[model samples]
Target: MPYCPPDCSCNLDGTVDCGGVDLKEFPRNLSESILHLSLQNNALEVIPMEELSRLQNLETFNLQNNRLTSKGLPDDAFCSLENLLYLYLANNKLTVAPKYLPKTLVSADVAANYLTKIYPLTFGQKPNLRSIYLHNNKLTDAGLPDHMFNGSDGVGILIMSSNFLKYVPKNLPKELFRLHLKDNKLEKIPKGAFDHLSKLRELYLHNNYITNDGIDNETFWKLSSLEYLDLSSNNLTQIPRGLPRNIVLLHLEKNAIKSIPGSWLTQIKNLEYLLLHNNKIKAKAIHPLAFKGLKKLHTFHLYNNMLERIPSGLPRRVKTLMLLHNQITEISRNDFAYSYFLIELNLSYNKLTSPKIHPEAFRKMRLLESLDFSGNNLNVVPSGLPKNLHVLRLKENEINSIPDGSLSGMTKLKELFLSNNKLKLNSIYPGAWKQLTNLQLLDLSGNQLSYVPTDLPESLEYIYLQNNQISVISENAFESTPNIKGIFLRDNRLTTSRVKEIAFEKLKFLQVLDMGAYSESATESKKDGGTSGDNLENDSEQATQNDK
Candidate 1:
């Protein structure tokens, strides 16, 4: 009953059911009443503007993902829809826009197209136009006169991500709320580029050619409502001076940031969710009280950084902490003596000999539900863990053995991750994982295990055992784990036949059988179905090393 894609003007105004269909041209049955029409992912060579001219009541139009290289719309094609609001024409092989359209149009999204440049005085008369998405285009302000976007006040969103913008355009509108210019070729953002966006809130300029030397005085003095600012994926080796005090989320990941400049964020009290991951910041150089007054901070991620050890004391009010992919050797005493309401901790991808835990280290943490200690060299886990630990990720480690009662204090443990650990012994302590009745996911990739132990929880849903030296998987290896959704046994020396087929039939909820470390083709297997799997983390790793 409900099937229409976005960027189409329907009377009901719902953007759905419009993707990758084999339509020759625009739909004629709904042409008149359609407010938004999208002929995307179709074999239509001609856009058939005459069909659109008949639609007087249409308000929105989307012609993306089509073979319309010739962006020639009749001058009066949209003269009927005087009350039109939004328009999207992305991925249409467009080079230059028609420069003629309705006057009442508000939001225009032309991203992922071939828009090379904009003509002077083009779209300057559209007073009500706001929220222009021009990302993934070849736009450049090099030849145009400065002072672009000078008077567009009613604008709200300007997504110019992945363009050739060398510097911030001059004379920006003050009413802008969200401006995304990430993955561009911007070398610098002149002080005047942000001079007028006083009411701006979210500015995304990540993956640019910018550095801290480009930041000038009054860097962020106007934007008081600025909350989510992403300066990550840049060439910034230092934090800019004089940021707005009201910023809540600052993403500085994947940069050449070596040390945070003092007095840069000295007095921001409302700041929360500071992501300094994938940088080259040393552990000792980071100030413990740098987040001193941010009591409301709930999430602080510093994974994939250049820290050799955990910072001794951080802000006491942190809830979620991520410290993966660092060079951490061991957890010293009083390493985390500050967190009072700590909920989640991730210490994966390090060189720890063992997951050493100190007494009362997590005693004050009450709501912790997740912990990722994967990709480390831990031989064993220390005693005295928190009681309510739900998820324990210790994958890709060098664990040889775990003594009896190693997880005794962890009574309410739900998931115990021991993937990629060295298990040489055949007999595990009775009831070693008995307390973990609610265990779910267990990944044992890249290990020297000969056989899977029979002590896993029954509530396990997902299991990964690829890239191991396992030669046999007994029928009782997963005897009681009926809720298992997926099991991986590929790329191993499985001497037994009928394992993959047998495991799938036994596990009622079997969905996937990831084997051999997920071949490179399986990268884009996600819910969104987009083939561009996140290469951001890898890029961030290289950026961190480059900055250091």
Candidate 2:
């Protein structure tokens, strides 16, 4: 009789959780002040007696996914669990291993189950087991369990993912700090599964099929406090030399890693974040001492990666440079002349036609701000931006108009991601952004606007004029402009509208007024209605969302 689910609740320490409920057995009379008990997923298949050691204040008994297999449970069950730590008998059909658990256990997540074998005193009855989730089950690698991380803080997070690991277990346990041997059947990585992690840190060896000859240099001279290194997917083609310079973040996307290893960017040099997308590197495999000592690199993701070019001794103190798609057609300005602390430049999709932007191509950027040349084949819009460039992502390309002053030398231009190009309808060109007076986010959604051009820009906040071809708003259409906080004119088509005198009253900081995804009209030309959605719903944003 184990059916206690009146929406389950019991605080003061006892944690009873009938997780996922679809029960098939063991749900009999709980409430002995449960101290952590989640019958995850449910449909119990036994191990029910000891009635949870007669509620001696239980302490974590999550029969993960239910339907048990092996028994030998009630030797006084958890014998009045003396603060039982955490025992989660993983997914069902257990082939054996469930012997008298509870030895002041610290953590045990018998991953997936179906015990193919595990009898080395099965955790010697939990000698304070410190984090162990036998990933996916069917353990191999020569039937691990010689003393699989003999506890005492030794097993500090070990999830043998997917299992049947081909290697990676040269007796690992120098107090491992977190090691999920991802999707196994490994091709290698043994040689001292990190010879006693020198205080390892976040290492999710992704979908392994392994390569890079299973890595060298004594497998990273003992992870020197590794910081988050997910060797993405895998079958790595190269670049796995001696990597462990206090890695800050290195997710070698997809892998078949063709390049990028000037000795691992000079031994990781506190690398800031380098996600090598796709990969099959070329362009002279970038070698000017490729990122010689990544002086705190700040985000450099090589998008799509087939690279026609863009990699050249890179390290102009990068600050976000994601080269989209690739096969870059060409756009030399000394390729960021001296990068001078480059700033946000994502050359979208690529194969560009003639993106000639050399008016000294940003003269040695003086902290050049956001600049993304959407998709490519840009027909126009390029006037040496960097006069304090703000944000300018020329979406999709083949730009039709809006290039007269071509953004009058961006005097601190705000945000302007010109939505999908070939802009039609009024073709927006009121002096090509009437010298953006500190304009604000203005993504013209997916262009082709029909009407409503009242010259918006008083430090506008956000105005993505939804899809195209409007109906009306032109009572002078935002006559005395400048005060907009947000006004995305929803999905255009419009009907009921007015807005005559003092249109939007100098927008005293109008906050977010998305006209119904685009004129479903019905703010009735809002006069007393829209001060633009309560100007930032105050109260300090409800005390910063209650301190999160």
Candidate maximizing lDDT: 2
Off by over 4 Å in 1: 1-58, 61-84, 143-151, 355-363, 435-548
Q: What's the TM for model 1? A: 0.75
In model 1, the number of clashes is 12
Predicted candidate 1 versus true structure: per-residue lDDT over 441-477, tens digit per residue: 6555556666665677787776666556665656667
* Cα-lDDT of candidate 1: 0.67
Point out the worst 10-residue segment of candidate 1 by lDDT. 539-548
Q: Each prediction's TM-score against the native?
A: 0.75, 0.36
**97-130: candidate 2 lDDT, tens digit per residue:** 6544566778878888876766554555455777
Best by TM-score: 1
| Consecutive 10-residue window with the lowest summed lDDT within model 2 | 539-548
- How far residue 293's Cα lies from its native spot in candidate 1, in Å, is 0.5
